[model samples]
Target: MGKWLLPESLADILPAEARRIEELRRLLLDLYRTYGYELVMPPLVEYLDSLLSASGGDMDLHTFKLVDQMSGRSLGIRADMTPQVTRIDAHLLNRAGTTRLCYCGSVLHTLPRGLWATREPLQIGAELYGHAGPEADIEVLQLALESVRRAGVADYRIDLSHLDVVRALLETDPAAAARADEIFNLLREKDVPGLAALGPDLAPATTQALQVLPTLYGDLDVLEKARAVLPALPRISQALDMLAALAKALPGVDIGIDLADVRSFNYHTGVVFAVYCGGWPNAVVRGGRYDDVGRVFGRARPATGFSLDLRELAGLLAPATASSAVRAPWGLEPDLAQAVRALRAAGQIVVQILPGHEHDQQEFVCDRELVLRNGAWRVEPLASAEPAARPSPSTAI
Candidate 1:
């Protein structure tokens, strides 16, 4: 392979794409701020113990580790920012009441999650700490929905599940982990024949319940059907109740319930949920209630949150039709230089032409041009292939 060739699943984000990501980042952080989620930026790398403290084995497998030259301790690049934020809540903030925290950054994964997945995911998320009630989970769910809405991505659905349901079933057969793994994989794959092949070793009732789980999806009626189909194990019953309540709370979103779905089950002790876009194979956002995540940090706070890949979300959203850019000739006069600086300060994307090179009209579609007009540097319209604005190009220019 060529030296410049990027590793598989790792690619560069060019300027046009990067602006969209940055715009979404700022918008989401502002949204989280409205909900009182103070921003915290954890480092990209940390000691292995801290990174892996609350995260489960799956995360460990994804994280990249290196020996720190100075400390000689194992350091790992974060594969997810949630655990790091949890540590912040438990150790640094140490607040007794509710703490709303949000973060946005890239996480390095050892492998791509899916065929088109990126190994370096630009993770943006919000975490609610010190609150374990269904209300907190509901609030986070609402936030997740709004995040996608704000990005202008439509036809998205949220699949809600409580791991406790599976835990309740699994508790019946602790020693049958091998059999349980087979069942879980079968359920994930939605392979009824595979599950049927392995059901004999499990209790007949458990087998029946597992069979119904793969089919337990769709609208609110799925929960109703689940009540009739699955056993009335206490924890499972409670989880179903919670899912029913969530369904009621989130009527606006196209919601589905997956009683058998257990993504991040070991890491998330309570409810686990994923948000999927229509026609997209993978869930764009995943989160759930993990109340015990902070315990290892010596302050077990109730925490629930969701994270979305910004790059993936940008892909889902409508392309940014209008971006900012103003062109100017090579600066010489003090007035021209001052005008360019002022334009930049005023938040206009100003591209000044260098002496040897002219501005690439295709790359930097200078919608507006800085020119000397009426003895003053003023913004003038440029004749372009596309109309920069409504009512045609300005006649004055």
Candidate 2:
């Protein structure tokens, strides 16, 4: 025995699950295509050096490393796809001014705690590189909203945050930079008590501003509350003003302004946001700008992108109806096999029971079964198939 082996946190997307995911991917691709985003696929693995060039802080820890046998250089399983997409724009596509791309695939990331994270995750998303204004941001946001709607999802909230706000506040106090790392983690985890304990008596106004962040999630009113406490920080004020403009443009969409929400990855340079539905512990879609990330690849093209875990999103949507499930036949006469395949090709589910295994019909759950009668193909419901009969004893035979 090979020890009944499998990696602890890894999993295979079985036929049924893969089909469901593919359906979702097709719908999203169609919606994106309608909006002018061409589809692209980057490599699953990349040279370690190129991969690390823009992997921002939190992302660096999740990448899986290995050594390439032929090249003798380090290689890594991509933990995220945005870095690779940026590489494509800077090196291959090299679109002179602007380019829009959408992609769907699996990414690998190792988690220290094997239980909470998977080594492989399916990702589907879009990226808009070269454009840096809020208009581009709005387009991507609208695409995300439309994609989810196309996927049959409703009732979700978007958490909007400004990376510039947090960076501005920290830059003011030189000492704050040293504690920047700790502050980043605290804000992401929403550890209000931890943030309070680190206090060396921050400016009264700064203190008030920080306090508003934890509860800043929800509608546009959060901006007003933040403005009252945000201190003399001009960058913070400008960021808030931009957010206010977005709020005005996107009325009726649930939006929240979280001043304390920090970017998990250093590559995110400006506005950052995430989309979450009720009952999901984590956000389904997340994206932000990274003006400096492109420079890592030796080009400074401004960029922003977001991706969803297709597998997780499928879980939220109802699984395909039983009748729609795909199943291959056990075996069939050559002609019958061709006919069954043709039916399947036309969107009808087909299953063929093998000779001598005809009694095994109960083992296969399908809406319709294909069989041969009078030298022709016949289709019948699962309930009509006869259950396999038990073998007769030698004496009876």
Candidate 3:
């Protein structure tokens, strides 16, 4: 085995991709700031129980656990940042009113989510705490859409669902409720035959409802079909209404409904959403309302937010063009140093050509040069076909 080889699902990000990821990170953090979202950076690892407080079983399976060297308590490498941010809101801050928090960091998954996915995802997102209304959901959803748009994804759609829709139907039958985990898995997989197999154990109405769920996906019209076919449970109606409200709130954006897509059924408590772009088979962004996720921290609050893997999102966009830079000769002279410092201070990418590396290909495209002209340093455009091995100036510093 090669010493440089990483694990099966993990790989290093190269210079170009890393630069793109960093730019996107700064842009998104700035976007969140404008919306009054304060940035919070939770540790990459924490005590297992606290870390998984609100994330539920799905995150538990993905988290990498180890025994703490000092505390001797089990610690986990976070697979998600939401719960940590939730804990911060609940315990650390303990504010009486709204708290808008955003975070960007690495999360380690036990395995790759898909064939072409990275196990270590650079997760970035914003969360709104202390609001339980549809307004917060709408706000976060809009921010999510804006995030992809700003990232240069022209065509994308958001698929919305409410866990309570499934929860409502399952509550009608104890058998169905008991097998909730199994049913959720089946629904996520859209396994109609598996759902049918459970019919003998569940009520006839529950069986019918479970089977129809996979098909209840499309535009807003799916909600109408749901009302027509599913049982007339009040909770189900309320869930459907909430979905309608979300769709109504965002008029111009492309929205979708998927009652059967219970990917994070256990983690999310209310209206959940996943954003999809054309190039990626998986949802680029996922989030929703998880009211009372902070309960485990002794302060349950209504919270909603969304996160996306910057690495994956960066992959969807076109490669970033090389940044233009100013080429300067390497010298310790005061004038040369001052000139370079001035350009750097003015927000320019200045690449100093080393004594022996003048002809070496660089990541940056040096469009301008700092040449000593008339006994003073001056900035001028480099000739397009400048010779790689051009002779140095006779009056070299």
Candidate 4:
């Protein structure tokens, strides 16, 4: 028989990294819980229709599809948690006004062969449903910032954008659908010349907006210039106004707006944002507003949320330091029973060496390993459970 192997872009987390990541996950979940966002575990897979309910744009292409034998219905591995959460808010929560929900889970996606994109990604995030004002957006943004801070990510920047602005400007013109798509693609790539080649069928006013598009990034000042040229575009103006408000609220935080950003999920009809830090191309956190996601599942509710890619965040993690080590008490063979009970009483992560697994002692993954040698007891350091310790395990009576 041929050897079995993991698929591309997928691999095991192993003990060392898995434990570390679990700690980070716990820290984030606790933070979310304290904010009154109850945690919910969405399924790893769902009916294809359920998964696709709120997802749009290139999302459909990235999802992994399969046929479920039990139900004989199409199923898809969840590509994102937002859609599933939206369904819950609509059909389950049934809140007339608002609901705050949190989730931590793994998501799967298909990607180009040889790409670094993990087929499996861990997501930790929260969703706020049924709020419509810019205040809701501000709340979501604040939570995102707090999540990063709790995770110890101090160096990062928030890149903000408004989907309604771009869409409103394009929909007002008479350009063909294909032409509009082409122009968007070009703008995404920052190809000003290709955008110009779309030919100036665009009205002079719209053309001027197009020209300024390349420079539509920076502080609140850009918002002023945009309004002067597209004064009648209320959708764009409203979104810019919200950005101005958000900037004022987020004092000392690095904030900027990108009007040309169109990569937001298909459901997002308002402000969209991504959080980035130096040395990484992937956004650690992504979120947006989806007012109609509830309507798709037979319930009408507004929703907004943001999720952080745990895998990407893990990539930027720094190694352990000496001050972070964990220690456990040593036990003698005569005191084995007492030591085990004492450790257990002290709320320590105690693992007794069950019979026949003596050889497995070398593989234990606790903060400290207790062994009964001769009449004395020994304590062994579990490097994975804590930071670096003496290379040797200790012995005592």
Off by over 4 Å in 2: 112-117, 201-208, 324-345, 359-397
Quote model 1's TM-score: 0.92
Q: Candidate 2 — which pairs collide?
A: 359-388
Best by TM-score: 3
The residue-by-residue lDDT of candidate 4 on 219-269, one tens digit each, is 667778777766467787788888888888889999877777766535677
Clash count, one per candidate = 0, 1, 0, 3
Which stretch of 10 consecutive residues in model 3 shows the poorest summed lDDT? Answer: 388-397
Give the Cα error of residue 132 in candidate 2, in Å: 1.3
Name the candidate, 1 or 2, with the larger TM-score value: 1
Candidate with top lDDT is 3
Candidate 2 whole-model C-alpha lDDT, 0 to 1 = 0.73
Can you write out model 1's per-residue Cα lDDT over 1-397, one digit (the tens) per residue? 8899998899999877898999999999999999988999999999999999888665888999999999999999999999999999999999889999999999999999875899999999999998779999999999999999998887898988888877777788653455666666677787777767666677777777777788987877887798898888899889989988987898777988877687676688888889999667889999999887888999988889999999998988766665547778896788888888887887767888888776355445677777787888777776663465532233222
* Residue 46 displacement in candidate 3 (angstroms): 0.7
The global Cα lDDT (0 to 1) of model 4 is 0.74
lDDT of 3 at 63: 88
Q: Sort all candidates by TM-score, best to worst.
A: 3, 1, 2, 4
- C-alpha TM-scores of all predictions: 0.92, 0.84, 0.96, 0.84
Q: Give the clashing residue pairs of candidate 3, or none.
A: none
